[model samples]
Target: MTALDTSKVSIKTSLAACFGRNLYEQPGAHEFLQELSQSAQEVNIQQGGYIFKEGDPSDYVFIAISGAIMLERSSPKGARHVFAFLFTGNLLGLSEFTVYSFSAVALTGATVVKINKRLIQNIFERHPKIAKSFHDFTTHVLHYVLDQMYILGQKTAPQRLAHFLLDMDTRLGRSSGQFYLPMNRIDIADYLGMSLETTSRSFSNLKKRKLIEIESSHKIIINDRAAILEFIDE
Candidate 1:
């Protein structure tokens, strides 16, 4: 973990970004943000550094201000599952229990703002609109997880890879149909529940079919978006 010089990064601004523009524009949003900023602390994490481990005290929630964070869990036998990769504006560390259910690590050098969970809950209690917006945000995350569960359970290797690419494009692509995969093939395999070789083979297969172009190990260009969609649908 590295200490961040947060003089220029506004905690309130980061919070507003994570919570979304709609919530930031809500009534009493200013007061809510002010309270949060007063207690928020920004931390910079080096790539692969742990943000919080599974079973750690869930005393704080975090907002990614920059870079990427990987949320994952490991079983007692050492089997691992990658839950999700969080980018800028993503909220994390909220749990239903006293301890974190999964671990968060910096997928890249990352900056995150941390706020005391108890303070946030108290503020939410006083701000019904903010609470509703937060509920909606969390529900949306839940839906994404459920969708991934379905894909992993039902999709074939190629289908799963296609879905993953499309999903990544939706989250990280530019207008040019290009995106950088911050994670490597092994990470993709772990997230998709496929072997690493299968994941790499799927990428090659897609490139061979001209549905996508792999510029490098980390860069992808969607050559035929429509065809890729059709492939997934088939």
Candidate 2:
């Protein structure tokens, strides 16, 4: 894939056209992004390749330009915990405060844009709206973390699985009846705090109940929205 020059007229025009007021017309958004594009380097990561490890210096924030990125943490007992499965337009490394708390690894062949901390800080200082946008993004992330904690702590396997799918549909905007599962079953299990077999069985059970339909392509179809909605209560 060709690298994007953030300053060029073509990229700017396309971004302006695609985003309209949300991007191009926003206060300092285009300028900050243009500044970012000047230094943003696109890097490719193969599936399973690490973008960064836990405890590493938080010098850079990465934007997922393409494919999915997995944020993972390992427990003392060596259990893998998936913090998130980030897709296109998702930002990583913003919540770490200083050092990376979780490792960012590629769930698939991915492309990322690396932005240094200095650049971000400078832009944020100049653009109050941009800073507020970042603040809002982090706040949403915190809420998501709390929601996951509740699911893992109190929800049963089926409930957790149901909640996970619903949340994925909302976050990924995959409400077109089909949602793709890029991460493997093991990763889903880890994310949901269940065993791999349990996670797999949950999917099978959902299919049997006519709540969802799973395809070999890793695509899932929500057959009955009401049934899926009431699953957590049951």
Candidate 3:
């Protein structure tokens, strides 16, 4: 097989290893996802694969099993704007309020459980808590998206990258003042809406400041996380 095919197979294996089954399928989390799991199915995507294109029909709401997905929009001019990174435990294509406004592409190989909207609707009708949980989750997502907008509109390139790193570190449940980055520089740039060169320079600047060290292509070791968080808090 070709190198690209080998890489896809490796990613698929890693994703399967990380998540043997959907976490939400368990008896918890208000049963919204669990009930839907009865009829749900999982699909795997190769790296750089498009899960759904823009203007596609919104049917199944996907729950990620492993890796990450990037939701982006492309203009006729060929410029691309990444909207957000959907990580494990995040849902994709759940636009109950209106039609989906973005397209999702796999950033890495990923596994997702596809849930029927009709099934989810029935569950919501029966259990009010499920609806409340979904509302809360979506609200949290909106707040993060708005925060990204603020970062994009107001923050400098360095600040934007710093804030993004800090936020991801916090979410990963790493120590309160410790962190790392799992994505590559280009992915980070796309997620932050900056050039790859800018992103690399920011990392160099951070390292020179003794704030962090690039542990590997897929990892960063945070040093003075306190100062980083302090700067981000401002």
Candidate 4:
């Protein structure tokens, strides 16, 4: 709930980055970004802190500026289902309903820009192009959810793990195929809908097959992406 004096410049930079160069380079995009920056309030969240809980009023939208964010939901019986791990430049807290359908939590010490949904709506009304861009962004998010559904509904345990690794590689990996995992095995298990033991076994299996190298619990290097892809195909 504590707000930081996040500079307008920083907000503009993060917004532009999240919107992508293609959109930012569009006519009037600079002014539109500035308006968004001016309306945004930045907040720093400690590790494991809740940004917004499920059922809270969907009054604001958040854009990640740094670190990782976990979007999840809990069953009445207290089981948790992780939806996604959002990194820098990802958007969250967007809901069509009056209340949030899921909770957003900081996976690490994170910074995020919070903008009132009403204010954004007003801005979007004025900037049709920006609104179109945002629509496209939401479409991408929908596709991501669909992909996760496919992974959970159809893939085997090892195939699910493979898809998860490839996804993290796409999101957080370097050209050298090394990436640092922000979430632990338990988080991975929850996100992939597998037991922690099964998730761990899948990682071990990949390591045994020389498809990936485990530098540490958090650091991973894909030794052979082709083989990993082949395994997933099999």
Write the residue-wise lDDT of candidate 3 on 1-234 in tens digits: 111121244334432332233323423433543443356666888888878878877886776667678888877897777777766666778776445567888877887766677777776677665555666667877898898899898888878888877777765434554444435677778778889999999888877877766666556666667798776667
Q: Estimate each model's TM-score.
A: 0.92, 0.87, 0.78, 0.91
Could you tell me the C-alpha RMSD of candidate 2 in Å?
Answer: 3.4
lDDT (C-alpha, whole model) for all candidates? 0.84, 0.78, 0.67, 0.83
Model 4, 65-127: lDDT tens per residue?
888999999999999999889987788877778999999999899999888998778867877
In Å, residue 111's CA in model 2 sits off its true spot by 1.1
Best by lDDT: 1
lDDT per residue as tens, model 2, 90-175: 77886537789999999889987787888888887887766766677677778988988988898789889988887777656556
> Model 4: runs farther than 4 Å from truth?
1-13
User: Which tens-of-lDDT digit does each residue in 138-216 have in candidate 1?
Assistant: 8888899898888888889999999989888877884368999999999899899989999999999988988888899
Worst 10 residues of 2 by lDDT: 12-21
Task: Give the lDDT ranking, best first.
Answer: 1, 4, 2, 3
**Winning model by TM-score:** 1
Question: Could you tell which candidate, 1 or 4, scores higher by lDDT?
Answer: 1
- Displacement of the residue 44 alpha carbon in candidate 3, Å: 2.0
